[model samples]
Target chain A: MSLKNILSEKKDELLASWFDRILDTYPVETAKFLKNQKDRFANPVGQAIHKGIGDIFQELLQNGDIEKVSGFLDSIIRVRAVQEFSASQAVAFIFFLKSVIRDGLADISLTPELYDELATLESQIDSLALIAFDIFMQCREKLYDIKANEMKNMTYRLLQRANMVTEIKDAEKETNFIAIHKKEVNS
Target chain B: MAKLPKPEELLQINYNPPPTEDWMDRPVELKQGNFCWGAKGKNLAAVEFPNARDWTPVEADWKLPKDWEGTVLEAMADRLSKYRSFKVFMDICVRCGACADKCHFFIGGGDPKNMPVLRAELMRSVYRKYFTTAGKYLGKLAGARELDLNVLKEWWYYFYQCTECRRCSVFCPYGIDTAEITLMAREFTNLLGLNTDWISGPVANCYMKGNHLGLEPHAIMNSIEGMIDDIETITGIRINPSFNRKGAEILFVTPSGDLFADPGTFTAMGYMMLFHELGIDYTWSTYASEGGNFGFFTSNEMAKRLNAKIYAEAKRLGVKYIIGGECGHMWRVLNQYMDTWNGPADFMEVPKSPITGTVFDNAASTKMIHVTEFTADLIKNNKIKLDPSRNDDLVITYHDSCNTARGMGLLEEPRYIINSVCNKFHEMPDNTIRERTFCCGSGTGLNASENMEIRMRGGYPRANAVKFVRDKHGVNMLANICAIDRATLSASMDYWVPGVRVTGVHELVANALIMTGEKERETNLRGEPLPGKGGNE
Candidate 1:
């Protein structure tokens, strides 16, 4: 059988292992709760991660574009971005799939072409990790932007109320207005 | 590059928490972005808090008072005797894990310590060690430990992390209110002068100047004067509002946030426009300027001290009753704690709506009615006309502020008002609304900028629900009655679900309110052009 066929057959088993590894990063108690809870509204993080993993796996199998894959990654990364994970730790879950794919497909016959195909799949995941890092940084930057804007917004109305803010006149508008007024008077 | 590990070896990363060591032995790490700045000595001294001094949580030495442990234990013992609820809560948790996943912090961040049962156990452990006979002898076996400095620091970090939203208490089989435990823990911390600057500064301001923003009498007028001008520009009807005027039938008190912030300012305008449309006899007081009490976050004594001004001002102004504006914890205090702390408000009478002759017998004892209840009554009586089409630009969703939903049972009044004023309204998932509502996550004065990361963590569940509605209903505006929700949820929405704006419920009312002798309003109270009004959209 072809390497793609063998890997596709083991997809469900591999995906479950990869998902379990991702949950393993959380505390044992929290991991158990995340596994047991089924409701999306009640367990949002777990639901996102589970749904994201399945979609991401399908995209990988279809050799989907990185842009399509990123949408899946965002669903998971957005939750992890605010969680207690450093940037490295946050993106590290993507790397677990590499080992899971290799370990799950161990029983297949070792053809040279299969080795090349496996390496290509591994490279795809490596590139995915890079995309995830970018997504993670975008989420982090958005958080910082929100924080700075909050400080400004909290005092904005108060400053306006106190008359602490003054409108800075546009110099170009001033010159145009002066020209228009002077012409009108001369005419 | 160095040689990479084999696949089997690579899977053995220590990123997973070790299973061997128990969570109890994991030393507390006071991470940056997880905690707020400590209360300044001057701010604490302004309120005359015991052991007033400068302190920071990150520092090795907290500069605690000599024999601080003895002080805390004595205070705990005293409180154990004083509040029967405290004693029962300390004793009654069965740890059925019912509340473990319910906490927003735990659900979002996955920090085991954020679990409500475990968070309570941080205090319950100390309570067990010092107070219970089994814990005193058995120690670790009985789930108790010594109240050392590490334990004290853990208490400081975890107690403040709680917003006291009481979502966990809903799931607890024993009816254990974990928020009261957090309140008790905070009260103990305040005894050691350990308080957050976000909370202590407001407490000091409220104590000295009668408002959280420290706006003096003239400044309050100045701010309201700005709103009055905006009201005139929008409606072409200048509202002549009274300040500290005697013989006004109702005294209006709201959180100073409404007078000082963007969306909250708009809500304040809504109140004025609504009152003017109905032509109610109401007055604002500079003496009791703030409705939300930050002192409630500090200690019971301080909360009582801050709450006393409202009744005193009512007597001074000779208003028959009080009408509180849109706020969250303020209503919680009014509904639960106000009458107990400073009661027998015999000077005031039950609020009766002059427009519809509806008597608020529910507020007969407190003599203070919520603005939503009053407005909902008016709408039910068909006394006011609201053009819901004016709010066509907004696909609105209601976020029940934790204090209002869980603290006070204020679920339907705001919804009734929202339905009366807006064309589009959608409720978030059933579990995430009403009594099971998640906090805006920055309540009880944890909304400081330094703790933005943790605030976002705590806010994740709430933002998740909003994201659900935004995806399902194209929800663009998050309407709430809480002032802090107006302030903090804006940042949270900006972070978690961009393009979603936050507003006070009354802001929507003001946008849809049609007043007699008013010009065509090209813009809403926010000065943003209404849908089909501004040409650009």
Candidate 2:
């Protein structure tokens, strides 16, 4: 069986499984949104499915013609940055996706021979995604550490400057107070 | 100033009795010729790279006697283990080299090796060879070298050369601080009783006595009395800086050396003047006479013992607040280590400067403060009189000492004081300034005559920045808040930028102080009045 035919047969199972995994950790609103979107594309679902599946391949792998999917992935990563999710958290989120894919594969019915082939393909995909996730996390952590340390040092310098100004004021006051008192005593 | 004896002469002084058995088994090499010098002519500058060759190997029989072995050996073993333990941390680094350009020392000195990652690589390479399983098995394939006696000696020499300034951490992607490694190495070396007399003698003195300078109780009192008399002469303030006065509202703890030394003594006078102006109930503690922790140069135990006096004295005085004086590592040790290591004092209240009503929020987890912060707040609240004209001729530039600026994030307070008091103030280049500050080249007690080359090399980046300002803005005076910075930069200024002087930020403040009876404050050491008309000369 060709890869295209195989993916077509398991398309619904894949989508349903991914939706469930994402829904498990995410809020009900996000779950509902995905479900509603799925329902709207069910009529022309095969082509839509092909496109969505193609997108994931394009986004995850470097060479697939899945521009839309890659764009979506980029948006998600960028949004995660806005949320201030650390590189560690992002890597964990990717792992969550892999588990979802595994659970979805479990629900699909197929011949034993075909099922074995599919499982192998799934594992290969999982390995690729994990490697990519790890690399991204490492880079992110490095950048964040530098930024944080710089901020810390800058804050320290500011505090020291503030402390110096305080000392100057106190010194001036003492010098003036004594001078005034001395004058009054002399007069 | 007369030059001190050569390294050879100084080493033979029998300053402290040598340890009986020396664990060091490495050969000593002294290189002739000007190797690390930076400047030319009278300003002949170079950094002495203490390599494996400078250290002399000691016979096992010559090691500290068995009775002395417990403390010395255990301390050495502990430090060595720490050096070994940090191998995992050192090896785990992916060598992204993100920290390369981030170091002010690297940027200022233009020395690639000063880059934090590169500096760590020197130690990491040694660690990989000895400690890691991959290195043990694969050898050259795993990029590990053999850790020989020479390697150990090299580690002791080169590691001490680092100031333990955390400037490189600012650019490190993993927040890997070479400062921590430097401290660990120093601890290990000191345990073997292989310390330069300059730092070790002070550490031992601060440990056994109350102060690093070996100032007796009377000497400390007399110094304060002298400051009081100077205050009376300048401003007619007969304020007594009471020592060991129980139940004062504040226990003003300063680096004891400051009570005896120049510039620092002037800063001490500034503290007295401030305390008098605010009319606060504060006393100097004879017990905790020193805020400067030389233990920071060697072991944590020594650091803890030196730091213990402050709280103990604070408790004795029953003061609400303990204010620290101008010192670099003193603040770093206090802000970063003292609170957790020495624990808290329930007897003392959380510090609130009475003059400013500024309540410290335990931000750094310590109830103490840098004196500049206390006084800056008073000025902000309009509690003091300052004449900007007094500092008219001092085209001042501020040097952010690594400890105050990097360790504690205290950049603003000192600058605020400088801007308020000095009529003309210029800033050094932004990259080498503030949080990214370069060391004064002699931090971490590497200020000995032997280490002069390293100090000058480290100070090159800072000196260049000062030079840039002097060339462009005509900045002739460098104002800093750290005592070590004052000493280091004063030496650098003398050599690199002739006629440019260094003063504490407080000294500048004292100069601009507005005494009511006087027509104008004497802002400059030259006795020049504030520039322009109506300025009393």
Q: What TM-score against the true fold does each predicted structure earn?
A: 0.95, 0.63
Q: What is the C-alpha interface RMSD of model 2?
A: 26.5
- Over B1-537, each residue of candidate 2 has an lDDT whose tens digit, in order, gives 998889898545321112322212224232211022111211101111111112223332223223443443355445556556454456567878666545434432333345567666656665566557887788767766665445445565556657887877787677777788777666655555544556656665666667776666766776677667666766655777688999888888877756654556677777777667667898887768788887777667778877888888887777877888888889999898888878676676777878777787763346787888887887888888887776776788988989988888998999898888888999987877888777787887766543444455466667767877998898989988887776668766754566688788777777777654543333343234445634553
For each of the candidates, give the backbone clash count: 0, 49
Task: Please list the residue runs of candidate 2 whose C-alpha ends up more than 4 Å from where it truly belongs after superposition.
Answer: A1-187, B1-88, B100-115, B363-365, B516-537
Candidate 1, residues B372-480, lDDT tens digits: the string is 9999999999988889999998999999989888887989999999998998999999999999999988998998988888898889889999999999999999999
- Chain A TM-score, each candidate: 0.87, 0.44
The whole-model C-alpha lDDT of candidate 2 against the native structure comes to 0.61
Docking class of 1: medium
